[model samples]
Target: MAGDEAIRLVSYDPSWPERFEEERVALEGAIGEWVVGGIHHVGSTAVPGMEAKPIIDILVGVRDLDEARACFDPLAELDYLYAPYLPEQMRWFCKPDPAHRTHHLHLVPVNSQRYRDELAFRDKLRSDPGLAQRYVALKRELAAGHPSDREAYTDGKSTFISRCL
Candidate 1:
């Protein structure tokens, strides 16, 4: 996490879905050979009217983890810097660089628990306004408390996410 960025939440932007779509198209053209399920726009940015960190988080479903390694170089060609975070669960990457990220890409196995959980959380946020608002409030509080610590801010949200699931 040497190049990790600070936690800075921003108001919801209507353009996030378009941005995700653009990235999804590029990603599909670049690595469609390995895609098994589909590309999804997840995370807070995917939920309309939710304040988030302003990064379009995309989840790409593949058949297997070992074979997904082939997607690394292709994604890098698209400016996605691969990160070794949660290697056993998913292949994580951030666009441009970790310090100034515009997107987060997660390559997960189609049938993996992590893939299901991510979509579940996003759907829950999308359908439940009160829950989404509460999540935003918690995020704001966490961002304030752990301004420069991305990991801490994320760690603080686990309990809330668990409850939602």
Candidate 2:
């Protein structure tokens, strides 16, 4: 776990998509052929009008984990620190500058279930405003109860996410 910060959900920022696009272009330039499918903006921040933790979650579909790993140096050059937080599932990278952490890159195989689930969840949230609102409420409640516990905050929403999926 990186240094724990209180979970703070803020109203959706209109600039989130632009931020994702900037990162996406940089990532595609850095990793070219390794990226089998296109990059996607997943997670709460991707949904318009959804209150979220202010972190942009990017999903990059690669040919395989090995190919993804090979791009570590390139990604690092872009200031993305490879954090094997979930090594078994995917390649995770986080920006070291916590104060300006505008992105998280999750690298998974193009056809992997994790990749599909994430895209589906994000799409569902975007298409269904009521569902998005319900998710926001759950996040707010969870954040209130587990302000300093990142694990708890994340776990609290598993059920809701599962249901959504």
Candidate 3:
């Protein structure tokens, strides 16, 4: 419900990984049984020295979309709000609110293309500082252009992300 938040980029925080780990542990405890692949920290925050939106991006692999639907209630209990974004591909969630999120969760099928690509993109950026810097530049430009339009800001980065993938 809070999807209309402004876009703001922050300097890379050394503690992002730890923040992610903390959230990962919480997610595992709340929905471990439904996780088929693994819980991962992905997105810009996962890379060192990359400017990001200060939200920890988490990826949780489940058996399939149908099975994943069961997680809505549990995730809600954990204060994750479910968003019907790309329901055909995966289940998306944010906490504590979408407008001002501290974390983003993507529930995808184990071993799916999206699951693999997400990890691949993160790994690629982690290995290449130049690439990461380029991404950061793009992100800053996008954020400025779409300061209050999260969807447009994200859409603007698709081409760059696809090329990286």
Best by lDDT: 1
lDDT of 3 by residue, 1-165 (tens): 345568889999999999999999989998999998999999999999889999999999999999998899989999999989988889999899876789999999986899999999999999999999899889989988988888789899999999988
Q: What's the TM-score of every candidate structure? A: 0.98, 0.94, 0.96
Candidates sorted by lDDT, best first? 1, 3, 2
Off by over 4 Å in 3: 1-3
Please give, for residues 1-165, the per-residue lDDT of candidate 1 as tens digits: 777888889999999999999999999999999999899999999999999999999999999999999998999899999989999999999999988999999999999988999999999999999999999999999999999988889899999999989
Q: What is the C-alpha lDDT of each candidate?
A: 0.94, 0.87, 0.91
RMSD after Cα superposition, model 1: 0.7
The best candidate by TM-score is 1
Residue 7 CA error for candidate 2 (Å)?
1.5
Q: Comparing candidate 2 with candidate 3, which one achieves the higher TM-score?
A: 3
Quality of model 3 by C-alpha lDDT:
0.91
- CA-only RMSD, every prediction: 0.7, 1.3, 1.2
Backbone clashes in each candidate structure, one number apiece?
Answer: 0, 0, 1
Candidate 1, lDDT over the whole model: 0.94
**Model 2 lDDT per residue over 34-94, tens place:** 8887899999999988889889999999888877889899988999888777787799988
- Model 1 quality (TM-score): 0.98
At residue 36, give the lDDT of candidate 2.
Answer: 85
